[model samples]
Target: MPSVRVVSLVPSLTEAVAVTAPGTLVGATDWCTHPADLDAVRVGGTKNPDVPAIVALAPDLVIANEEENRAPDIAALRAAGVDVLVTEVRGLDQAFRELERVLDACGAERRPGWLVAAEAAWRNLGAPSAGATRHAGRLRAAVPIWRRPWMVLGRDTFAGDLLARLGVDNAYAGHAERYPRVPVEELRAAGLDLVVLPDEPYRFTRDDGPEAFPETLPAALVSGRHLTWYGPSLAEAPEVLGAALRAVYR
Candidate 1:
């Protein structure tokens, strides 16, 4: 087997790959914290990598995600003759496929027992019945990701897919971008059942002043990655999100 040193440029894959193949990781971005030991590397943001620093690392492979990483930087890395594996996962199936690809690239084959276990767990944890029943009465949710311009999760996004899976309809499904900015008044008119403040992308907290919302509306701060990105993390989300939704109903 070829000994390959990998520099991870995307945060999610940085975390995922580190878990799948810790020994192969030579360098990683600041946000890759799952494995803990790789935190010693010089910090690099997900969108912008430290090119010279990466070159200095002289990795055999560079891992990145198509959506999270900028194309020009990937192009630059390729121009420097660095082998790059770019993953684009829009859904659960795509996510599993990308994981498989990463494992294969790192010379790690699938552990059939683990796959079977994960599959069994996923199958056993069915969708929330309460959420489905409450769907009709469910408030169209405005998942504000950013504040200044009021960006939200739009239709055709991973978050939107999760919303659908959770039995709640995304109010911004008609919008264009995956995350778009909308006026506060527009949100009020949309008649939302809940205003979900995610813990990331904007880091909305309970003490962060819910006075911005009308007194009649209910709001809850939720785990952004759990509601949005579905990967290995998703194995934990069905239970977590179901509990959250059940709480909202109760």
Candidate 2:
């Protein structure tokens, strides 16, 4: 069978398809940075893609995520008669299922080793040992994705689910919106044991993010790729994220 030529609008999906079936991708958004030597045509950013450029690629399939992409873009692709596979990944399980579906649509012969390894890694993740931490209890944390206006991970977020699995509970996990713009003052006063910061959507570095929180609160400055992107990074997410979380306590 001729390989399916793919265009990936989502960064995570782009990495997934590219890593699992190299050369299968003909176009990817500018944000698809994984596999750093990716040779696909740059279609533009996730929020504002060059629709005409993507359509012109004539990919056999185009994969996108509901959160990272806009509806009008997906609709425009569909209107142009391009076969678009849209995925919604709210949690770890959904991410795995969506990865498998996206790969199958891309005509991958089987599940990639990375995908299998990612699943196994999460399954075998042991509970967080509080004994090693200065704070000896379950960690109630607030995950801030962006600043300026200060947006946070709220209910039904993929990152929150991963944190939950690692025993770090998101303080805003019960909030109404998946990503909510809460006041910075409120976040600081949210009675959090830790402040989880990732380096994307907004780059939260040691100097940048930690200063905002009270000196009493621990900060876990982590890789946003591992925390947010649901691709091969998932395989190392547990270890990378767990270590970051643990470091704040140690």
lDDT of each: 0.70, 0.89
Positional deviation of residue 180's Cα in model 2 after best superposition, in angstroms: 0.8
lDDT of 1 by residue, 124-233 (tens): 75553435646645456788888777888886766666656666667888777778888887877787877777777687877762557887777766677677553445
Off by over 4 Å in 1: 111-122, 130-139
Question: Which number leads on TM-score?
Answer: 2
What is candidate 2's lDDT per residue for 90-187, written digit by digit as tens?
99999999998998999884578998899999999876653237545678889999899899999999999998898888999899999999998998
RMSD, one per candidate, in order: 2.6, 1.4
Q: Candidate 2 at 57: error in angstroms?
A: 0.7
Model 2 RMSD in Å is 1.4
Error of 1 at 1 (Å): 12
- TM-score of candidate 2 on Cα atoms, chains taken together: 0.97
- Model 1 accuracy (lDDT, Cα): 0.70
TM-score of each: 0.87, 0.97
